[model samples]
Target: MAPSPPPPAASDAQYAQQFLNTVLSQRGPSALPYAEDVKWLIRNHLVALIDAFPSLRPRVALFNHKDGRAAHLLQADGTIPITHAGAVYNLPAVLWLPEPYPRAPPLVFLSPTPDMLIKPHHPLVDCSGLVAGAPYLRSWVFPSSNLLDLARSLSHLFGLDPPLFTRSNPPNPLPAAPSSSMLPAPSPRAPSEVVYSPRPYRFPASPQLAARPPPTEDPAEVFRRNAIAKLVDTAYAEAAALRATREAEANALFAVQAELRGRGEWVDIGVRKIAEEMEALECRLQDVTMATDVIKAWVTENHKGAADADDAEAEGAIQPADVLSRQMLDCTAADLALEDAIYALDKAVQEGSVPFDGYLRSMRALAREQFFQRVLCTKVNSAQQQAHVTRMAARAPSHYAS
Candidate 1:
């Protein structure tokens, strides 16, 4: 016998409450006026994060900072690689909660180890080592935005192509200007300051810098370029947002379809519909093939008859017979093409490769083609009959006169 299944885990709310209780017991109550509410929000958000990403649960830590305020630190779960430019970084990060909780977004900072080096090139990242940017922090809205959203946004940013400046070495520094002789000599620097030689800081070079005209002292052109850059960035951000939304919607639709397929009735209904479509397509294909065969046989007989007549007639009369044969052959070819298309569609339906709606569409298109071909054949037959009647009438008048 198979082992019994484990019981369902606690609900998210229940887990959050338990975690909140544990944290309060270990660290003592928050000194803030709305301590319970803040703690509840933090616990709920953290629980949501862990639920979304189970691997993060073991690496996540909550503690009180030196200021006696609560903070959360989440170590990289190993699943998500932190890469910038061409280099992969390993930096655990801290989340500093605001005193007002949901009213303001939390501050995020990279907790780099002794050997880790991180360049500040990301728009959200600052020289002071804080990660505060729009959509996650700066443009955060209460009730709609949460910690998990922030984490997701940050994860997405890390996956993008890192800023160019971060991938390139710092530009060579210009030589120092000649010291003024009038000024007194400066005192020697301390050993600590002298030993630590920081790279000269410069603004990140934009990818389009080469395309842009050389730097001008004109304020108007500078403002224009800045405006253009902002517009481009905004458009890119919107496009990314739209793409993410579409992907999420598509995933949700697939999940729903999978769930529906699990039910016996749904599966039976879908199979029945598919079978009916395949039968219809097969019937239509047979009709088209028969029509094409009839046209081919008629064309072959007409060609033989025309060739015999052409041998007996004058050379000028042979041209008309040949033209008629060519037209008949063209018609036969068209019918055969339509027949082939229907056959392919039938095969696809039988193999279950085509969706029901697609199958229906193919059937409709084939039906239209078949109808048009029938109309053309009928017109050709009517014209031939009229011509035969006209020739007989002309001959009958001549015979009566004789």
Candidate 2:
């Protein structure tokens, strides 16, 4: 039979080149909703990936399986080959780009062959053969990360500890093969031979994976979770403290109101007592004024009689003007006492020490007494002047006859 011609190698190279060209052209003036700066950043990252991994030749394609349009990285040669459990296997990897490229980190997946088994010891590799949960990927920064750096990191990780293994098999150390030249040697299997069946490479239809959540066994993860819990507890404590303070303030306000009510009641009682005292003082002042008026009239009448007796030369009926002066003085003293009482009442009202209405009533009483006293004094003085005139006229006529 004739030898079969080698498969066309230019097909993959053409596809990769075309995909790169499409990504580069996306930065041009187009009616895409993305900003020009974002497109430019994505282009730069793609260029970096191409320069770093020329053998892989990463290509971009529209991911139509999801609800929104997104880009995915497709590479034919992007596989991690590892030797585990005395056998070699190729772990196919796929990189997925987020909708806003360069702003978010790409998701990586390691789709193993059906025959290949994966362990959970790998830091980035999940049980579902998904490579995620790395601190670098979690804290991705825009324009700072590129596909090349992530690919290189994942590739280097395999060298440290590859988790690929054969199903239901334990790893056994291989014995050294001795070289013999004298006898015919049996053929040995190639060390680089893949132990598993090959299958067509394809990206995951859906990005969702059955990978477990980040393990809490990790010390860093535990510390982060505890810190968050502590913060929540602290916030609750602060809120409780604020509530207590508000309650205390409300209680204090109630206490102050109660005290003010008590004080107001006491002030009312004091005002009532002061009003009663003022009424009594007003009555006393009126009595004193009336007595003063009576005394003044009696003094004027007695003085008139004394003047008449002296004019008629009746020795027994004549009394000295000194007695009338003494009576007037007593009347004046009574009036002074009434004025003092009025002054004290007015001061108390002005000072707000007593109720104004009660004090005003007392003042009215004193005013009436003052008016009556003034009228009585005026009438008594007029009577004395008339009696004096009569006595002087009698004396003058007698002197003229002499």
Candidate 3:
């Protein structure tokens, strides 16, 4: 069974009350070390920092000043997210704010556990876990620099050179790290995930012992091999992520390609069907010419006198009434229809819906038919009019000549 978690903290109002009480406790030598005004600034900065990185929690710790002064100070402790070699890893660290903070840079330290080892020769951190030379710390401007920016800068620097690494082979029967109030107590139901406690804790390193056993390998070799293995794992993970992205893109392209191919096939089928219809229409040309000749003959017979008119005109079929002269009108209409059809073909060519060669051939055939229809209509109309005038003139002279 897992160790049970610690109890939750006070409510917002209660926490505020607790903070006020702690900061205002200035009655004795062991009272809160920060001034009244400095306490307000610290609260504001800390509140702002937590808002940005909720993983860090605020607490009090014994701060060892450079002048050998040990004063109780506010500490922000937890892991910060760092991206290194295309991988994100949590870096457990602590941020210590001195009483003169904002006027002075805050202190930073790597909080390594027993299973972890401090990296050697890091440009920013030392063996004692103290951090220095950070760009933000060295150039900190008073009244403007805050804990949030400090944490962000340190996170960036640490990512480039991680200050801690896990041991490849930890010693057996390890002693537990000393418990401090700086870390949140684990809950029995809590999952094994890094929790950014609003307030977390501190730890104790292995106690100094006179007769400790030696390690099997040099510390340097063990750390070096661990570093190499971690790098290999990070590279593999990044490559796998890239490969997944590429495969998704390829699948999308193939789907588009399939849809386009289906559309192309449908277009090809439509064109072939239109071409077959055109061929069938061309085969009916002889029948259309015969019908035209029959219409012309019927018109010529209708103009004859009553004695010469045919008594056997077709029965129960629709015939032209006085609404219009049907023979000439119909012939002109067919000619105009062919002309309009050729115009449509011209548009189809311009739109590139039909091939240029097919457009040209179809237009020529239609234009020839229109020309012949117009000529035949003109001849029939002229004859009908002349015959009407001749009859009228002959009747006009008979009354006077008698």
Candidate 4:
């Protein structure tokens, strides 16, 4: 046999007395206990409270908790006072002590509460945020409190009168649904007018009672149950279909986003390539400008040297070949510029960045004309120098007499 169960722990009366004592020590005269506890379990808790917080003497009272959830009952009528909030009143409180007293807090909660409120769609009744949940208990520190005070605080939020009718006014005509042949009809009574009729009372001679048979289920009910099952199955199917539709729509949106990302990447790559080509063209243009400047300096030197040589020879001048070289150097500036324009046209065409065909044609024509004119000017200068050289040579022979 299982070991005899340990002797029962302290009784409810003991627990009640301990709780009262704890409260009285803290609140003194402000403390109150249920009338049953006051008469049956008169511990020092109430007396101590009366002496400590004298003000509570008038307001505090022991009340009953049978009709509704109340921690204290009024001594005058044994009426349990309803709390203001979280209509639950059967809060089970006990004296708490730590491994060493006054360390950890006390554990407290209502005795028979359900956890229905933990459901996802639980409805709210009033302003207080109290909720029903698993095991359904609230904790309170005891060196600081007791059950009666807790009841008073909760009563302020969602309290209902003992009858649960607002302010003792009960609803007169109970709400009823319109008759749909769901209830049995009441039997009609026969009218009576006899004045001295004996009220017959029937007494069974031997009081023999017959046993009645248990009721049986009808075949129609089984069919109705089957119909309900089919309806539920159809509803579940519809819900599953709706879920599938939503999932498909989400997938379609993701696919669209992926396509857009791919297009964006291609656009970025194209833009980068165009930028690189433009930079290269700019660098080539800089080189052309520097070459032009170098050619200009060479032209200046050649022109000065030829002019000095002409002065020293009097009627003679530099040779045609020398003049041609000087002119070519001077014209190199135009050649360099024409070369730059050709390169610009080719770059613009390849990149397709410069959209104007008219602009391209005008630039090309300008380069061609400038370069061709520079060449013509060099030729003319060469011809003039040749004539001067021939004349100078003919005259110079007299001085040497050769």
Residue-level lDDT tens digits of model 3 in 123-233: 677776778756567656557778988888777667666777766656674554433333222222123322223444433233222124433666787687568546644
Q: Against the true structure, what is each candidate's TM-score?
A: 0.32, 0.33, 0.40, 0.21
lDDT of 2 by residue, 43-73 (tens): 5565566556543435333333334333233
10 residues in a row with least lDDT, candidate 1? 189-198
- Cα error of candidate 3 at position 79, Å: 1.3
From the highest TM-score down, the ranking of the candidates is 3, 2, 1, 4
Model 1: residues with Cα > 4 Å off, grouped in runs: 1-17, 24-34, 54-90, 161-402
Please give the lDDT score for candidate 1: 0.53
Tens digit per residue, CA lDDT, model 4, 164-222: 22112323544332222111111121121111112221211211111223246466865
Residue 48 accuracy (lDDT) in model 1: 72
Cα displacement (Å) at residue 274, model 3: 99
Q: Which stretches of candidate 3 lie over 4 Å from their true place?
A: 1-30, 66-68, 173-402
Q: Which lDDT values do the candidates have, in the order given?
A: 0.53, 0.55, 0.66, 0.40
Pairs of residues clashing in candidate 2: none
* Local lDDT at 176 for model 1: 35
Off by over 4 Å in 4: 1-231, 300-402
Candidate 1 lDDT, 70-119, residue by residue in tens: 33332222122345334453334545454566666765665332222355
State the displacement of the C-alpha of residue 6, model 1, in Å, after optimal TM-score superposition.
Answer: 21
Per-model C-alpha RMSD? 34.9, 25.3, 23.4, 26.3
Candidate 1: clashing pairs of residues: none
Q: Give model 1's clash tally.
A: 0
